[model samples]
Target: MSFNPDILDIISLTIGALLFLMVLVLIIVFALEKEYYAVRKSLILLLFPAFFLIMPFLNFPYQDYLLLGISGLISLAFIVLVMPFNNRKKISDYTFSNKVDERDIMFSRIRLEEGTENHNAYYTDRPRNKEIDDAIKANPSLLSEGSTYYNLFQFASANASFDTVEAYHDHLYKDPAPVKKDVDAKQLSGYIKAWSKKLGAVDCGITELKDYHTYSKLGRSHNYGSDCKLDHKYAIAFTVEMNKDMMAAAPAGSTVMESAFQYLNAGSIAMQLAYFLRSLGYESLAHIDGRYEVIAPIVAKDAGLGELGRMGLLMTPKLGSRVRIGVVTTNAPLNIDKATFAPDVIDFCRICKKCADCCPGKAISHSDRKNINGDIRWQIAQEECFRYWTICGTDCGRCMAVCPYSHPNNFLHNFVRKGLRNSYLFRRFALKMDDFLYVRKPAPGSPPQWVKKNS
Candidate 1:
């Protein structure tokens, strides 16, 4: 059999052209997305494929063998990336026994005025936090003047969203109707899931309410120090996405504006769901911003929403931490979704410390997950994080913005995410590629043009 040099040349050209086109398209997308670093990196990468395209023109001995080897390697790499692998871990492995006390949370503690009865009493119980809390209090409050990124209009816009969410507090819980509607649990559950998507939710799920999911005590509002008596059997959890462009600005005023707006959107959805459940003759409560009896992340995770990422945020399959959670607890009989237990996400977080490295507050830990009161997980320094938030006048979403998983929910990134879940080798390769193309530490992107104009 005669070896066809012409055929080999044709094959090589096709491979080279495909590679070049793939990266070229990526460059165009990056540019459109305002990812300058990615575009720059892609330009440099084009040279590699260029060499392949010109390989036939260059006279070199063993060139045919080299091309054949390269073709084989490419095929093998693709197979390795797409192959299914078992790396899933159970949620029970990292479950925590300690139920959180909302009173101890930063939002709760910050609301306590110094020298007031509640403040004095709280510090008396946890004297160690007194100094730390006081230090954080010394900084300018969030969205206030003197703090970084304190734009009057943007902050006001954020406050308006927050105020609206606060209004929902009074309407969170309600009694069922006099006549209970005859309904199948499965049908109702399916209806709620489908309807929730139409109500601006990116994803929705259900889970039986667990003890640890509830806060030990109520913290915000007039219910301070009271035990959270939520006895709802089922929780409906859903996520509303944060605008990617706004979040790309991280600690900027635009980010907080988007955050607050999403919170309102989340709250609105939750309230509607709660009201609907009540009308169906089921007691229900909507847990939104400014009023939460249950921990949103834990509930969301149990509802099969997502795994807990290193930043101590709910890393949804599509949007990662770029989301606000809305949970509605009800006595309504409903079907529950199987909880998602993705060890691949955790494993990726272990290796990819971009969040930790990019944290301006130095609050996120670079160390491995530790056993904290029986829970094996990474815990951020809340005081340090809140302190930065107070000074910044924003939630400082640098961690979320830089997360590889937080990339736009599109075909290209979704393909990468699929590879990440399926194979460990692809995870390593993807991480390396992410670091190279996007840079290990990406700068905060410019705010949207509209936001800039307003500023």
Candidate 2:
């Protein structure tokens, strides 16, 4: 069909105007989001639409047809990108039968004194780790003054939060009330989930306790090396978000300050949930920091909270890895939430290696997921990560800070997340756009003004 020149001009002008406005809006959005790189990139992008806007006025023959053809190609690309495809498998489709031994975790090894019997026994059992463990221990410890990014006020604040969390350890478990209170499983589950949100949890879910969820041995405290005795039938898992501004300054004092506070926040919420359950004549135990019998990320995954990311942390739908996890296991009868396996998270992680690129410790794996204990997954080098933590005197959150999924949970980002979840082609487009806007490796942000005030 022959196209009318007037109609073609109008359509071309409309497309150009829309493209210009979109780029303009993105510039403003990037500025508001504090992404200077994106703003600059958007400024450059304005030229693209500017050329199209003037295309109609040019003396060149068949210009209208060219513009129409270009618009058609763009529309076709958009449709292809938005179509959902390659949603392969649920996270549970993989098998992981092996139980983790908590005694082998970094935290457990860090607590072992050089001359103590526990240390000697552990070294005897695993002599290969002795040299590396000692080297890591030799570094200036987390929050200690002799390390990078030391700030007296920030470090003290973090320590105080950690100390307060430790205080909740004693209240993790309590005897059921003398008079049993019968409750409806579904109703109680709903109540607990709602109450958890009221107590600062970003999300909460319950799952039937599984054997792989529990640690084979106790890791920390005086009862170290003892067999784990947890026999709870249900596990309630929740997450509390970390402040994006605070965490942006990764490996800095403010980052640890925020991390510590969130740990305490999550722990306090878990303790309250456990206490409330026990009062209702249900036996429950809060799995706080340094006192966990359960593998929290696994429990959180099973509870439908989030999926595991390449950095070996739970990547929540809203907050990504920028959150602290809390768990409370109990014998209380409760309706379990079916774990909604997000193939998008896995698919995105597969293509996006930003975390690995930004990791200061080089701890995160750059390769694809491997068969880890029968389940295909990416595993970070824990020793390398912890060693860097010791050196920095902070849990260097470089990986979390740089993850595209770790962007602030707001309308602008949520819109991107929606597109990310909907289409595999959009995932590739989104990644490129993200890299163009935010850059592949963003520098660590400065701590808040208050964190630097006076000191």
Candidate 3:
């Protein structure tokens, strides 16, 4: 083939046009999503066309070879960028040594009345927690009158939702009449999952119960400090979506209201599921917010719902950490789902510390994940977290609100989730984009219309 300058010029113009069009499309996409930083970055990518167009006009010696060399380098870079070489996030190889103690948790400790046997027994065993626990005990309580972000109606609404959850707390356990129904394991499992989703759950799965899933002791109501000895064969886990708009007002009363509301939604689904299973003539127990024998995140993880993220929350594919989890344990025969190990989820969490950065109490760890008991997982400082909740009169969901994974489930965000799930490079790039496109310290949004109106 002869080295014709006209042919080279045509090639250059064609390449430049395609590059320009691609950048334009990207800018439009970002703009439509109201992603200012993404639009800005895409506009900068207009430089991609500079060399292809200007190089053709440059009177360089051996221009054809120069263009070929540039093209080869660009193509190689493109391949490397898009390659799926990142390791799939594997579930931590480490497992918990034993069951967790509910009494040791902040919530359980908070409920301890001062100068009582329950209080003395706990403080005597772990004196270190005494000072801090008491400090939290003195703070303005959650949704209290004088606390930050307290609105008369908002606090009342949250309290009402919590009160409703408390009502269901005592109803978690019940005896089965008899084994009246001889059901196929797979069929029953399918029915339960479908029924859960129909009851407003976003996702549901079943996992064979594990020893580590049970708490070592009860923490709430009259059963405080009693050993939790649940030995169910299977666990049904489900998640309900927390409203994105309401969540945007995190660290405020609206977030607490949303949290409490979702707790009820998830709890209702769980209790109904458990009741249905028991009616089949098998033992079943609902694990709601206040009366949980098993760890919901661990159960959800094993049930294939989602993987645990850096904030010690279940990061579901659709809703990330923005969903509330509920579980039901039963002896009824049912199929179990295999948990997925998306190393990319871990990889993303390793880099994106938005949740940690936004935590008011500095409760979330900013360091590399550590070994807890035996499990290699991120351990959040429960005392600090709950203490902040008491002070703010809210659940202090700043971490959840700022989490990169907790974005609204729309096409633009879901596409990013897919990238985070599929490629390591994309996950790394996505975190950078998230920080750039969203913000390092995003301002909390306003409360919902209902909340505002009531206020």
The sequence of per-residue lDDT tens digits that candidate 3 reaches over residues 259-285 is 999999999998898889888999999
- For model 2, the run of ten residues with the poorest summed lDDT: 87-96
In terms of TM-score, which candidate is stronger, 1 or 2? 1
What is each predicted model's overall lDDT from 0 to 1? 0.90, 0.88, 0.84
List the candidates' TM-scores in order: 0.96, 0.95, 0.88
Model 3 steric clash pairs: 88-343, 89-342, 89-343
- Candidates 2 and 3, the one with greater lDDT: 2
Relative to the unseen true structure, what is the C-alpha lDDT of residue 267 in candidate 2, on a scale of 0 to 100? 92
Cα lDDT tens digits for candidate 1, 1-455:
45345888888788889999998889988888789889988999998688779886766899889888988998898887888864664323477567999999999999999778899899999999999988988999899999999999999999999998888877765678988898899999999999999999999999999999998988875898999898989999999999999998898999999999999999999999989988999899998888888999989999999988899999999988889999999998999999857888888898899999999999999988899988888889999899999999998899999999999898889989988888887888999999999989988989999999977
Tell how far residue 217 is off in model 1, in angstroms: 1.4
Regions more than 4 Å wrong, model 3: 1-76, 88-92
Segments of candidate 1 deviating more than 4 angstroms: 1-5, 86-92
lDDT of 1: 0.90
In model 1, state the lDDT of residue 262: 95
